[model samples]
Target: MICIDSISFSFECSHTVLEQISCQIEPGHCLAILGNNGVGKSTLLKCIARIYRPQQGRITINGAELNSLSNRQLAQLLAYVPQHSNAPHMMVFDAVLLGRRPYIQWDSTSRDRQIVSALLEQFQLTSYSARYLNALSGGERQKVFLARAMAQQPQFLLLDEPTNNLDPRNQHEILRYLQELARQQQIGIAVVLHDLNLAIRYCDRFVLMKDAAIYRQGGPEIITPQTIKDVYGISAEIIEHQGARLIVPQMDHITKAADDAKTTANHH
Candidate 1:
């Protein structure tokens, strides 16, 4: 289990990004971090990944203090897939194989090659394994980066908008794979998501952040229509279909606001 206890972070400009945020994530469960833009979702993810340090808090991994762990030890326990990815002029296969660096002992091994190959095939990137990452599309490159993270075989996976560049089908496919990885391998996955319905469908746990703090955290039931209004400042209708919770934003409400603005403009 990873326990975040009263963590707070601020930039050098004195703008606080995270404020006393606390949450717990365990193996075999996928936690979705949901919030509006600039609500410290990415910052919190970076904090958990140790890329950003908090001023006042302690993070524990499996009952041990995170700060006590060395760099290599931390890498073995945690892997991060960023929202935007940049790759060098190298083959995709070789790029993914880099994830195995934590386990490699100064030389590449057959197991590393096998793991990279399997991930490429799993993500349907086998044909592009020999292609340079710069030559691939944004979505394709995102898939390769995810493949690399999985290749790391870490205990915890931290993703920032993992579905950013994926098509609808691929989004579902990747989420399903991530859930499977959590259950089958007992890996802890914490992902930042913008789509409420996708979080409902795939995530078993939820953390709603607002104003740099955790506003709510629980199962899907915590995601109420009012919650949407509070978090997104938009009216949404959550309906049920075939035993699934679906969130549908009330576009008419937005349109009404727009019409009101237009009326005020005409009057002026």
Candidate 2:
């Protein structure tokens, strides 16, 4: 389990990015860090990943303090995928094999090779194993990055806008896979997502942020239309369809109603 306790951060002495933030990433569950852009959603993830250290408070993995762990030890416990990744001129297989670096003593063993190969198959990148990462499309490259993180066998995973490059179909597929991965492996996952529907559907918990502080954090029940309007500064409506709840922005709903009225008037 990863515990974030009353952490605060700032790039400069002034202009705090996050203030008094606290949350928990529990094993076997996926936590979605959600808010409007520039509200410190990404900054919070960076703090947890240790890419940016919080100036105050503490974070711990199980019983070990985050700052106490060495780089190699931390890598063995947590894996993070950023919002944007550069596609380097490296083979797909080699890129993923790099995730095993924390464990390799002098040379990689057959076990490391097996883990990389299995991840390639799991992520459906086995055929692209020989291809260069720079040669693949954006969506494909994103998958390779995710597979690399999974290869680390970390107890916790952190991802930022992981579906940014994927089409609608791939978006759902990847999120669903992550949900399952967390449950099956008992790995705690914290993902930053913009789509509320996707977050409500796949994530086990939600942390809604406003102005760098969490406005609310709980299960799917907390994602009401009122909360959406409060966080996003737009009116929305939550409706159920096919045994699932969906969020529709108020403007879209109004436009659709107007269109229907126009069609009826034309028929009359």
Could you give candidate 2's per-residue lDDT for residues 1-268 as a string of tens digits?
Answer: 9999999999975698899999999999999999998999889988888999999999999989999999999999999999988888899999999999999999999999999999999888999999999999999999999999988899999999999999999999999999998999899999999988899889989999998799999998889888898898778889999998898888986688789889999999
lDDT of 1 by residue, 128-220 (tens): 988999999988999999999888889999999999989999999999999999999999999999989899999999999999999999998
Candidate 2 off by > 4 Å = 252-268
RMSD of 1: 1.5
Question: lDDT of all predictions, in order shown?
Answer: 0.92, 0.93
Error (Å) of candidate 2 at residue 231 is 0.3
Instruction: List clashing residue pairs in candidate 2.
Output: none
As a whole number from 0 to 100, the lDDT of residue 124 in candidate 2 is 87
Candidate 2 residue-pair clash tally:
0
